[model samples]
Target: MTEEIQSKKNQHPADGQQRVVIVGGGLAGLSAATALLGRGVSVDLIESRRQCGGRAASFEDSEDGSLVDACQHVAMGCCTNFLDLCEQTGLGRFLRRDRTLWFIGPDGSRSACTPATWVPAPLHLVPLLFGMNHFSFLEKAALAWGMVRLAVRQKMSDGDTELTAAQWLHSRQPERVIQLFWQPVIESALGESIDLVGISAVRKVVVDGFLAHPKAADLLVPTEPLGEIFGEKLVAWLRGQGVAVHSGRAVTGIQYDESGKATGVVCGQDLVVADAVVLAVPWRAAKRLVPKLLPPVDESFVGSPITAVHLWFDQKIFDLPHAVLVGRVSQWIFQGEEENSVSSEKSCRAPAKEVEHHCQVVISASRGICDGDRNELLETVVNELQEIFPKARGARLMRSRIVTDPTAVLSVRPGIESVRPHATTPVENLFLAGDWTQTGWPSTMEGAVRSGRQAATQLLKMTDMKAECVVKDLHKNAFIRLLVGQ
Candidate 1:
């Protein structure tokens, strides 16, 4: 549903000026708008929500009067395009990069995974793998063999896309290794199980994220709520660049000429005309809005769920900023308020005392628990935390909130990559941008930004506006080149 606001008369470009109307105010739409505006093009970005960021947004919680993110979104060093957009939006400084990943066993045994600094690409993780006490020596050897095979293998052929990651990995690695090492990473990254994810998608994650470079696997988390990062800061930056920002306005339908060129979009009763249009909405929304250009709804492109359990304690429970829980319903636990302590900000609406110790537990591909009782989920999460962190055993639970997103991201199912369309469609004037598009990446922020940049580049070319919008991927390090012979 679109949040209605006072209709500002639709602004049309003057003579010789190119105007573009971008539907959807998510990262894709925002990225396209920024790129087009940088090229001296007029942009009118339309969003249905009161704030920008779409699925990666945050809102003020009425229960505890705190601003909580809908779901935790993290980025890796391999995400060059998304990092570039963060730099452009002045959000680079608010990001915190942690190289070491902490893993907590069910019995509360802690293990840290940190790449070897002196070691080169691919081998940089060897030290950590051998040093990790959670897995047996034989398990480590098997896992190493699997990784070697993944790094040395060629790109997925048409036949390979038909196989699931689980099927391929199970054939190569043991079940213990699959459950301990591969399953968590695959589910967290693709928002689906290995049995459901395509082999190509899993290969991309491993090659680009882990084996590409030493720093490629580093995780970057936002210090503030997503609304502050993408909503307030991004909108402010866009306004400073002379682009028209229209929040709380939804584009009901696209306005096309008889010649089959998209002129603009219909926002409520207002007809905002433009020289070009970029439909950056989700797959379902895009199908409903412009079915002529996009194909019919395909169940194959359906999305998966992500659930977050936020808990506030009277005192600090965990010392680490974040930790991955092994053999638990909760996959990752993030210390929300301790890192930067921005909870006192006016936008958060949180009482100073209420946010003393805020923690968030994230469960990706959480279809099993999405419909479960909220109180039961909270209790289960608390029990898991107490088991993992001894400090949490006696901590008083001040407040708790559970946020479940049924369609957090498109499922990376086998054979789904072929169905994903490119930025440039058959229609000349209509462009598409979203994480679901064929960006050669999964449904992450990086993929969304890449799709937007690709859309902007194609739109510029179609309009005869010469400009480069797409950013190149990170170059492979020398070690990878020597090992893989790329």
Candidate 2:
């Protein structure tokens, strides 16, 4: 049976605890391992990469050697499960919640939209919707009504959901509203062009993200670089929990018995024996390790690209914490928190030089930008920022880099829901976990965490152990419940 793949000899549980081997150290795998804590389970997590965190990751600047995120990852207050994990793991202190979302209009108009916590559910969004100074009064009203319509819209059939969001929005929303309000917002949230994404996905963003509660739209941004937060801090927490974390260890295949039940995973030249396995890697990787357990990775599943342009200026140019630039190539701009340049180890002391102010421009769903020309893309982005912010015109560009993740997020495309697999696989001992899985949410941090917790719970349920890690969504007030008929 172990001829095709290497034999996975069992590493028997030392204390009669259930041995759970998670073959991935991303957020999903990390969360799954966290859930098994104190549940009479022994957990071991293995990540192929030298560091975990997967897409929510960062890289060292080639010139300055400072760490910068590939793309900014933000959490919403609606991401109950992700927030809970952060809080549970002591990573909550690293999160900085920005209540105001700054929107920059085409005419250089700036609007700071902040939802009201004191106000009732749907009404809380009234201030936010009306605060868009770029839109006319009628345009604002139209946008508000369109949101209500989408919120109340019931789930469509699989065939009907295959309609693209742009197709559905063109008929329901106004031209200007679709361009200024819906396009940028939806693209930023979904990480896919509205023309390519499915309608049902947009509905979820509107309902769970905006209408659920006053704080649902609250943005939880990490104060530190994601590399340190997840790759280092998160891994340290897992290690402290008595969970064996093996970074830089890649699992080549999974070993199953005659009944097709997984016994262990073959990592490198070693086999991590386990009573249960959580294949928490991406769909492509999952399919590679256990081909018999998964379907072909075809057009049914795809990824959306996200690009982040890192820029260092001689001085601080933009003052806002973050800005959402509409009607431009830039979707979101964040002020990097790094204040000091990377210190050289040979110097034995830090050298005094002009402190370069760093900022990043994030473009979600940025496919074929400037005809795939990096210089042109950079020039256009700089010009756009200069046009929107007067201060940017005088700032001297120091060093810059364009980072693009071609397959950053799972594309919630037409009819993709039917293809997303459940946590429990056909093999009784194997469970699946990743953002690409069906988590009733888009390809987001919340979805990834929920997927992991779901897989953990499924494993726990099978072992007849306590399995409660998934957190509830933000509370929907009675008014919202009645409006959306939730």
Candidate 3:
């Protein structure tokens, strides 16, 4: 899918102006733009879509007039980059959630997990160990034991061990626990089956979610529409800062200088010159742009499909936030309160009437989920919901839309440890930034934000931007701690 030209307005740079061209207006690109703008550098952001926000986007249903997210996406309570963006852009208030994750199991069983306390940092691990969702009491104990072992070990040392997540779980966890809990969670996170996902990657997720905090694992789903939250705000902010954001502008090729530096970018018969370029698109997109500039990305990098089944019901059938359904056609279900509230309140308040507000039920982390067998999938989900929520049995189906993206995320396979691209590429002045890149975390919002921040920080070295508040604090804290201790 090549994008057509959306904008050609090129403003001439004033005297002593530093320019940066960012391709792909995803979280990474927008974050980079914000950071660069803060540093007094001019940026030009080109997005392939007419709208901003790459994957973290939202669409509206014309028939029902309800807002629908691209996927049932959320963040962790401990996402540093997301928090930083919120603070920087004054979008913190929108990052609202009840911090409750309800996991529904094979037999219509439901478990709710919430943050136990606010002790800050290290003490956050308590609630998870004692939490009731997803893991069994014994499995939680085993995970705790594994965390202790993982924490004590060295950092930046968990490399390619030719081990699978399933193998790691099998070795460290009981067979029953692996089948019942870890399999679903791992499959969702890594975008691959547990038997294929690398052990180290799984360990990283375990450390971040399980070991980080008692509430760190709490689901932080966005309340507002996704594009409204980050994407649109970013574009408006950039334009306010005199930055050019070109939606539907796609780069077809990159021209290199004699020294192997990025000189210009070609997009639909347009040759845009730039002092620096950031390829913030996905791996496959990057492959199309410049295959020789980076490492040989595995076809496995395209990964598997993640289908989100959005089913609208006449009456509200579920009240739980979201649930994990084991031993069924779906693994996760995200209740769409936003969509439900969009419809008439009278409809929402009514019981199992044929006339009611719309409700969206999301089936997430759907690996082999396809659109061919729509009836089969819907029947399975409806039956399951009937078992869990008795009112769902008679609720009329208003709309059932099945959305699937094959390139949802990079497959973190067992030997895929080497496929992730680094920040710097062979082409100087051209860098890469995406969750799929080596950001330590899984292909998550946190990882995406981290990658963006790192890329911005690196690019800042070429500019004369003042150190950020966080950087200044780091310096101050290091000096103060050294003086006090020494």
Candidate 4:
């Protein structure tokens, strides 16, 4: 586990002890605290909201006695950070099923693509040769060729170029291929259009999804609620380690020295002192907090909006755990699995055995769906699902809600790469940690966890260097090339 990895060296200040303060209680913030606390450092985590987990938060619907994951999120097979954290917290065992993505078209056409085995180099082009859904065999083959060519070309040029994903792909391959396959995936991954998204950022998703591991594309949705699997467990673990965590204490201001080093944070009416501080909030919140911390970078880090539609049905409308729906009211639907047990009147009981029971459903990357007009959106999904599943025509709507974050993720457009902050910032005792930062992966749960690990490692290194009078790069020259010239 990263906890022990960062704990080996208990580097402290001249006073022989140090305290670390982490802002935000999301995955990134909690992960940072876990890593820092493991290294024998006292830690304090403050969350501005009443609850933690940020976008990853969940709650029990008092109306149903069933858990509701706000937007119905899942992890992919390539999510190393999620896997590591799961293992660390012993939550890995709860991951129950591997689902093959079913891409359903508006006309009721269906295609199931299971996770492919990972292979390196030329042989990795097998799936494309066979083709899937809209793409022809020839088109798929060409697309595969284009990806390899681009990967090689990127290695050769190695210079950070400013170009949208649409421009880059169109320049290399046919426009139709990108419109059919690339556009849909890109919009879902980065939460924006290809015309505005960056080529490098989109390419990272493709490379990691298609080139990295065999099962990288497979969907891993936990059978239980997200909080049950990780969030609650993580909080318990942190508290067990003697780390102080305060919820609903939003940071109003950051106090810094003349050198621009962060000394502590100002929450509401309290000033909390610390040896080091990590700003692990979302991109939108982070932009508000440290706009001047990194020069020529602040403006680019601001993000685009992402919306999620949560709909509950009277029965199981879509039997599939999760599927990507193209040419529909929504891009994807992640159906929550049956809860292990339900509580009724303060007593635990098995869920009612009936087909006409409440079922959870989440629609991802939905657009043109009015938040106030629930009837309009509900009617639309009902009509759409009826076409796909004739039996769904009888499914009655119980309730529906829309969740949106105007800045869910940073715009992955061109030239934005340079704006992403590193684990260690110019401010000596302050660091940046979030999915938007450079975690190699795209804006994902894995990326967020990785950023947390990076931040913790960095804070520890700074302390070590100060104590020993020697500078050692925990990343150890890995970022030198990117820092100097490519």
Per TM-score, the best of the predicted structures is 2
Q: Give the RMSD in angstroms, all C-alphas superposed, for model 1.
A: 2.9
Query: For residue 341, what is the lDDT in candidate 4?
Result: 23
TM-score, predicted candidate 1 vs. hidden true structure: 0.93
Between candidates 3 and 4, the one scoring higher on TM-score is 3
Cα-based TM-score, every candidate: 0.93, 0.95, 0.85, 0.82
Please give the range of 10 consecutive residues that has the lowest summed lDDT in model 4: 467-476
- Candidate 4 at residue 457, lDDT? 81
The models' CA-based lDDT, in order, is: 0.82, 0.86, 0.67, 0.66
Q: Please, what are the lDDT tens digits per residue for candidate 4 over residues 1-486? A: 123212322343335568788998888888888777556677878888766777776777656565667666677766766766777777777675563667665466666665444544234336533435756677777777776655444532226566777777876777766765677777887777777877777766665555444555656677667775556777877888877777777888888878777777877655677679999987667767887765455556656666666655666677776666665666677665554222222333444533323334344333345344766766776677777776578877666666666666667777666667788877888988888887766677777888888898888888773221111212212232232232
lDDT for each residue of candidate 1 in 189-224, tens digit (9 for 90 to 100): 888878788887888888888888787888999888
Q: What C-alpha lDDT, on a 0 to 100 scale, does residue 376 get in candidate 4?
A: 72
Give one digit per residue, the lDDT tens place, for model 3 in 1-486: 233222332333565466678888888888777777656666778888888788888777655455577777777655767767776787777665656666666666676656566655344555644565656677778866665554443232345366777666666777766776677777776667776777677766665565554555766767777878767775786778777888876788887778888777787777777777888898888889988866777554655667777777777777776676665667777766653554544434555434444444444345555645778877876777788777788887777777777667777775565767776776667878887888776777666777777677767765545344222111112332332231
Give the winner by lDDT. Answer: 2
Give lDDT: candidate 1, residue 84.
Answer: 94
**Higher lDDT: candidate 1 or 4?**
1
By lDDT: ranked, best first: 2, 1, 3, 4
**Would you give me the overall lDDT of model 4?**
0.66
